[model samples]
Target: MSVNNVRNIYCVGWNYRLHAQELGNTVPESPIIFTKPTHALVEMTGQEIPFPADQGSLHYEAELVLVIGKAYRPGIRVDELVDRMALGLDMTLRDKQNEVKKQGRPWLSCKGFLRSALITKTLPFPGIDNLGKTEFVLQKNNQEVQRGNASLMVFAPQTLVDYIGSRYGLDAGDLIFTGTPVGVGPVNHGDHLALYWGEKQLGECTVQLG
Candidate 1:
């Protein structure tokens, strides 16, 4: 299925130990949840992404995205409910995010802007068992800037689904962006971004300052 099949887009923050520490955030005792509206999605069609003007430090966060294929049921396992997976870029306006945090505001303006969520074509779910071997990354200008392995996630996909399902009610078409690892960094005009699953390049696009 394509991005059109996707419903709610849920995201986890501070879910990686090193990522949390790098951001100077306390390691959360529980998963920190947030979301992006469907409007934020932009398929990696090799189009140039126009960065929001004046939103300082646009950052690239590579994450493993799960496509929920079944209706939510309390006892269901991730492997049973999800049929596809993909690599995504959770683009953030870092400076704006930090400014809003100090004022106790929502991250919506900093995260849910147009074209903030970049996604690629989905692949068959790499079942929980093979999670250890499943790896993804984001390469900026031919250099690997960020990478993630499901096995290294602090809150595994199952746990995220379990936690989010209990409170938010995940639907069959919903998408859960598990979380990003420690190497997130800034994006800029003229920069080329690519997402990879192992040696396979899933998708790509160029950045153009808006």
Candidate 2:
């Protein structure tokens, strides 16, 4: 599927236990939901992500992305909602995020920016039964930088889809970022980022600091 088809970009924060603890945050009882505009979407193949000129502290968050196939109403089953899967990068402005957190403000500027949502091509989703065995990895400069399994998620993908759907009905072209794992860090110019699902390499791209 093309990135241009995505209508909504929903993201969950601190869904991984180690990721929460790494940033000194307590595990949430419910998913922490945020959103990025559709324009933020960027394909991973041979793409260059320009660093946000306004923010000095930028970070990379590797995540499992779910593509909604059927329109979801309240109380929809997770198995029926997801059509495809992919690996993605939830690029963030850490300094801006922290500032907003201190003032109790929303994270629009911190989380939603141009080319902030980078994704690999969609793969066939084997259904919710395969979730437990699913794993994703992120490589930076040819070395493993971050990795996580579905088992480590505080809020599973099914739970998130159900919960989020209850509050906001999901449409067919919506993409949900299941959240990042522990090894998230800053990115610089000329850095290479590669993402994988299980043993299958998904996508690779380079960073272009502006």
Candidate 3:
């Protein structure tokens, strides 16, 4: 399914222990939730992604994205919520994000910009029992930069769905970005970024700066 069909793009932060430590953050006991509006949706169509002209230090966060096919109430099970899976990029304006954080403010500006959410085409869901075997790898400029597995996630997909649902019931078209792994770094003009599930290339996009 197309990301355009999604209503809300939910995101979890610091969900990977090593990633949290890499950024000098303490691991949270519960999930740190945030969101991106639908307007931020961007398809990984092998085109150049125009960088936001006003910002610098655009960072790439490779994540596992879950596509919800069934409407889930507070008590819904994980198996009933996920319809498919895909690799996604949670693009961030890092400099702006830090500035806002220093001032103790909400920083949607760093995350919720046009074409900020880049995703691959959805593939059939790997059942919860097999999630531990799922893995993600990211390449920038043709070099491997990040790698992670679902087994390393502090809050597994099931727990994330349950926690998010108890507070806010999810609709059939909701999308969840399950957070990034370590080695997230900046991308510059003319750089290429690619995401993969094992050796299978899922999506790739170029960075365009003006």
Provide the TM-score for each candidate, comma-separated: 0.97, 0.96, 0.96
Once fitted onto the true fold, the runs of candidate 2 whose alpha carbons sit more than 4 angstroms away are none
What's the lDDT for all of these models? Answer: 0.89, 0.89, 0.88
**lDDT tens readout by residue for model 2, 72-112:** 87667777888888999999999998899999999988889
Residue range with the least summed lDDT across 10 consecutive positions in model 2:
46-55
Best by TM-score: 1
lDDT of 1 by residue, 109-184 (tens): 9999998999998899979999769678889999998878888878888899999999999888899888889988
**Model 3 RMSD to the real structure?**
1.1
Query: Model 3: per-residue lDDT, tens digit, 1-210?
Result: 876678989999999999999888899999999999898988887889887857868899999998888887776777778979888999999999888889988869998888889998788888888876868899998999999898889999889998887787787889999999999999888999988898889889999977
TM-score of 1: 0.97
The order by descending TM-score is: 1, 3, 2
Error of 1 at 191 (Å): 0.3
